[model samples]
Target: MNTDFQHGAMGPRPPDEDAIMVLLVDDQLMIGEALRRILASQPSIGFHYCSDPNTALKVAAEVRPTVILQDLVMPGVNGLDLVRQYRQSPATRDIPVIVLSTKEEAAVKSEAFAVGANDYLVKLPDRLELIARVRYHSRAYLNQLQRDEAYAALRESQRHLMAANLELQRLTKVDGLTGLSNRRYFDEYLAAEWARAAREGSPIAVMMIDVDEFKRYNDHYGHLAGDEVLKTVAEAIQAHCRQSSDLAARFGGEEFVMVLADATPGRTEELGTGLCRSIERLRVPHLASRVAGHVTISVGGALAVPEADTSPIRLVDAADKALYQSKAAGRNRATMMPEGVA
Candidate 1:
């Protein structure tokens, strides 16, 4: 018997992915030896023999053979049934199987094919013909495995590219200094919210917030300190806009805006006054600020039930006017858009 005919150690052989590996399951030791002699001359082909019909599937899985040569008349189990089991097992399901039988009857060959056998061979087949069939089936199976691996790699690459594109879009909408939504994103969101409010007959509130004497504060404390103050103020505003329907954004340098969907006038005023107190509580010292020793924000809010015919920009203008009133009346207070002010 050739040393290449392996019997007992059913553990997997080292992976030889490009090589043609064959697993033969036959009850007779003589038959295994005969097949071994036939394949041993071809160093490119590897062979494993499992005499126990019950463990054939296990050995096939461990060996990861590209083709299987199964004997038809095993003692305990039917060879056709074993082929069906191979088709059912995930590890060996795609492997090609060639059934060896003594009978050359067409009925027997048809049954073998019905049970998932790839080819049927008469016992002691011509060596040239056997080798040809083995090489043909092994080549086709290996090609399929390569295609599956390539497709999986392509899907993984596409997944990573989509994630990177989403991250890039989010970065564009964010303000670099304050980590709030930028003015462009704020405008887009406000328009959408306004249309929704109009359709639903809900009130929308907008607040224009300005840091007190920001230019003087920036001159007194260095620009870095000014950036820090803006970051802190942005955080305070974000804390107030906790609802999913509320949005806070950096309107421009030293200025911010908040949009509250479905808010009442009283609720809007409450949030505006609360935001002022929240910043004053931070106690970011502003020596140049005439409003307070610590940081304070002036808030001007406007509430409106949006109409389908009117543009949303008018609400923003109204809030800006109210902001001017707050600055004129000792810059620390919150003021509502006066009645009859468009």
Candidate 2:
């Protein structure tokens, strides 16, 4: 709703002045006919008439007139009162009203002005003045409407632009192969989480996961089949790490990494063991895997409270060293470093 409309011709031109709308509320059919004929020469002006004094307000809402002309005295209602009603209505409040009276009494003119009348003229006004007044009021209303419409369109465009940017950001951080976080995003997110843990005195954890006998699987099953296994294993890892701040990413071929924020060494061990079990449940056959008849993962994890002296790389090295031990002791298992190790 907050919009700054540039009042320039460069903004927008309302559907040509060829469709100006004017409404007349009077109980006289003969007078309506006379006024219609007078305005007919100007095809740009669309004139409508309501002969029923009681139903004039309803017809005005339907017509959405830019300018209204009301007879000062109707059969039962005073035209000044109708002008006040139009001014009070949210829909018709901005419309210009002109009072037309057969008897031009000075007091009546003053009363009409007090009741929201924009202009006062005698019945059957001068042709030049009627056209000029109608055109002026019509142009004023249409200009404002056009400006509002343009600002609305601009706001919609800006909303679409913002959504598109967010989508692009999401796509850039996603890994195309496994629909997991890409390495670039994983590295940045881990660094950020590490810094946050340091400031908050919370423990940050890392898990280095590697597929057992992956190269043998690729060699025996072909690269495409190996790709499918990689995808399945990546999904298994992602499913096990449920924390919103935890990140799972394919570190490289046959290797994946997870960064867990606000996690303890004990919690890290539990999650790493769960990841091994989840992959085992997949039951994907791997004839070349020496550790098992099916595909499996070896996980090495470390957790530490970040200090001003200790760096993120040191914690990563500890996790990497533990992963080396898991692979050496035989794959398809989880290994955790000693807790409180700097």
Candidate 3:
């Protein structure tokens, strides 16, 4: 059979800047040398040869060849059988294969083509034809490699962008100094939790906290000292509500809010007391305070099973009232709203 392989069958696109790797599986060592000389002028083409047909697959895996040249007849192995095996392998399935044979009988060439041979050629092809086929198949192989690399890179970039977007969303709702959710996040979270509680028929609790005599502390210790106290108090609140669903937020200067979902009136009171004790335990000196010798906090708590007609604002208002009641009765104490305030 005359070797007249068409170039269009190679690939639609040309090769990229990367080098192309080619593996030759010819039992005859002389044929391997001839191939090397033919491809020596092409700098971008890389070549590997295997004289033992049994080791061809191993060499193909090592080189990860873009194109393979197989000799049809060998001592113990038929090149056609090797082509079938290569086509079956996940690593070599996509690689193009061309078979080299001494006989030009049409039946033999047909069998090679049937067994996954991309093209059939007579041994020692014309130098010009050899160069053309090698370059054509090599270019096709590198094109696929480049496309795969680009797709992988795009996926990685998309993953990084998604992570950055999530962080940006977190920052928008987080207080810079106290590391607690800001007022904006608190309001939104309260409303969403209230709605969810209404749907689930569960009770939600709110705690309104105030720093006892904060102005006097700031006046005596300086504003910077007051800022540190707020941060410490915020941390204490966070430590108290370690549950994933619990939210402790800075409502504003000197005021903070804690929202708890599926919580009971008793849990509310207990957490409120714990928060007060935590602040008092800080021992942040508040000598100017009338409430306690050290820094202290007043807590107001309210629990309600939300209804369709009720809004989260009602719960917040109730908690605020109780906070004032705590200050009025005495600071450094936790007080729940009067029973049946709604």
Give the winner by lDDT.
1
lDDT tens digits, residues 140-210, model 2?
A: 87667667765468667768999999999998998889888988898888778888889899999889999
Q: In model 3, what is the error at residue 180, expressed in angstroms?
A: 0.7
Residue 231, model 1: Cα distance from true site in angstroms = 0.3
Over the stretch 157-246, how does candidate 1's per-residue lDDT look in tens digits?
767989999999999999999999999999999999999999998888889999999999889998989999999999999989879999
Which 10-residue window of candidate 3 scores lowest in summed lDDT? 1-10
lDDT of all predictions, in order shown? 0.86, 0.83, 0.83
* Residue 38, model 3: Cα distance from true site in angstroms: 49
Write down the worst ten-residue block by lDDT for model 2.
1-10
- The better candidate by lDDT, 2 or 3, is 3
User: What TM-score does each of the candidates earn?
Assistant: 0.57, 0.57, 0.57
lDDT of 3 by residue, 4-24 (tens): 111111222223444566678
Query: Per-residue error at 198 for model 2, in Å?
Result: 1.1
Model 1, runs deviating above 4 Å: 1-147, 338-342
Error of 1 at 66 (Å): 24
TM-score of 1: 0.57
Order of all candidates by lDDT, from best down to worst?
1, 3, 2
lDDT score, residue 339, model 2?
69
